[model samples]
Target: MPDTSSYLNSLPAIFSEDPFLGQFLLAFEQVLTGLDAAKDEPKQGLEQTIANLSKLFDPSAIDTLFTDDEKTLKAFLQWLSGWTALSLRADWDTGQQQRFLAEIVPLYQRRGTKENLAQLLKIYTGLLPIIEEAPDRPFQIGVNSTVSSTISADTAQIGGGTPHRFRITVTMKSSSTDELARQRQIIQAIVDLQKPAHTYYELPILIRTDTMQIGSRSTVGVNTLLGSIPTA
Candidate 1:
């Protein structure tokens, strides 16, 4: 009100008279100019921070991570490690890890049981396991067998280890040697993780060979590869 234009015009002279005041005014002017320019367009840093915060609050945004067909589930598993309370292995496939995470509550509920062990094996290997308890018998002579007879007790032992013994027989249709080797690695990994620390397991992978179809157009007989032919 008191000659505002003249007072404003006198500011430069007043600032110039005091060097510290001039530097302070110059910095304050720069700050005001920057804020004015910021008003013309959105601040990229602030907008990006807000966008990230919005994503964190949105459930659908998080769901997109688990719903993605490829890497999302794997990433979710890594995030859920603390919540799931499971020691996840890197060698396990993403699907296997996800299944483990999904069933972790139930598996922990039934931990150390035959059902839990079988479920764990199935989750990792996609094959049902046969759990046998006390599969080994002590070798001894039978009282019913005669001492002089040629047919003795027929002492033969198969699996002798801890009371817990699980056998997983995988019958694969793949004839590729590489496939078989890969399957063995998969089986070994599953066994190492799924089995109890003191338990022993037998993973016998059997390759299935189909018989040839004999027809009028092709009458050639299939030859066996691994054994000697019987002589009549």
Candidate 2:
């Protein structure tokens, strides 16, 4: 239709170069162009998307796009965590989640022990974690015996709480209720994952102040934990 003369010329001279027929062909070509145009955006969009497809799955992107609607983002991340065989807390923000995604698949297999529990708590919360196994029993290590001012000896059994009872204490860098609550939730999630199935635990979070600490006080949650121990 656009090159009606060329079309007619390609055919034998016997074919008529009828104006109406040329016009009809032109309209038909216009209709085809419109149909293609209708699909062009999505089709081209898919091509570009396929080229840079990694951004869709990028863990960093998870925060920005989905953060506005928490429910949707949580749902999406749930699917991702499920695939990775990870037990993730819903409250974890973008950065923590990104870190979690970056961590190895073996973390799930490495759960259910004090070593792994403390390691994971440090990783997720960026705080020192002290894990005492059978805390009700008398302390085997000298430092382990020192109870923090926060702990109530009367409430806590001499050895621990339950048969498999353990206690975890972490000093808080921020006294803000919001930050503390968020950390508490994450800590609980990690504890839930790492603790033995039959065991239960007590989590004591202390609000640390600048006044307390120099030498031995600096090392808590590892070999030495500060209980009623004197501060330097």
Candidate 3:
């Protein structure tokens, strides 16, 4: 059993560097404080602990973590597995609960690559299985036209000279058949918006409807589309 006190020591190092995650860590601390107060049934207390941790990431939060440190994010998931066993003690098969708890506790002790990235991968697959090495993978932001062009009924204009529908195409690599069509749609949106340079745009707005696959089952999940519209 870890002293739990020792875990506090890692805080300064972790917090000093990552303010946003540090604030999240503070919230985690509050959950611990609550756990201490509910010392009656380790089971019930554990359930509360799990609930609090779940709050740390409300589904969508996983996307944010993947966008940052995926490895660390995966390592931290051991805590989630342990919390689950504790939370389901009464309802789950007693043997299964004990087995899961035994398996996951060690992970919290030594986070980072060594503990068991495989197990973590299995656990987080449902949450963010398709984490991209880069944001909007497959379709990365490539060299877009620095200049804009337009064509009117009478003549054509270049570089912001006139208002013409300029078609901008963002290519997404390794896209699945299902996503390839949608990727084109999203890129078209970028052309339609006529946005300026250096901004993040939520593309493929219709992409949420696509059914996501688990693990390496689907390669196309990571592609994304973006459009660059010059102000000039």
Leading candidate by lDDT: 2
* Model 1 residue 69 distance off true place after TM-score fit, in angstroms: 10
Query: RMSD (Cα, Å) of candidate 2?
Result: 9.7
Off by over 4 Å in 3: 1-86, 110-128, 132-232
- What is the clash tally of candidate 3? 2
Candidate 1, 116-201: lDDT as tens digits: 77776666555555454433444344623222211112323333323555555555554689868876786677557656788776
Q: Estimate each model's TM-score.
A: 0.44, 0.48, 0.21
lDDT of each model, Cα atoms only?
Answer: 0.51, 0.61, 0.36
**Candidate that scores best on TM-score:** 2
By lDDT, the better pick of 1 and 2 is 2
Q: Is candidate 2 or candidate 3 better by TM-score?
A: 2
Deviation from native of the Cα of residue 113 in model 3, angstroms: 7.3
Candidate 2 wrong stretches, greater than 4 Å: 1-78, 84-96, 135-162, 211-232
Please give the lDDT score at residue 112 for candidate 3: 30
TM-score-superior candidate, 1 or 3: 1
lDDT of 1 at 6: 24
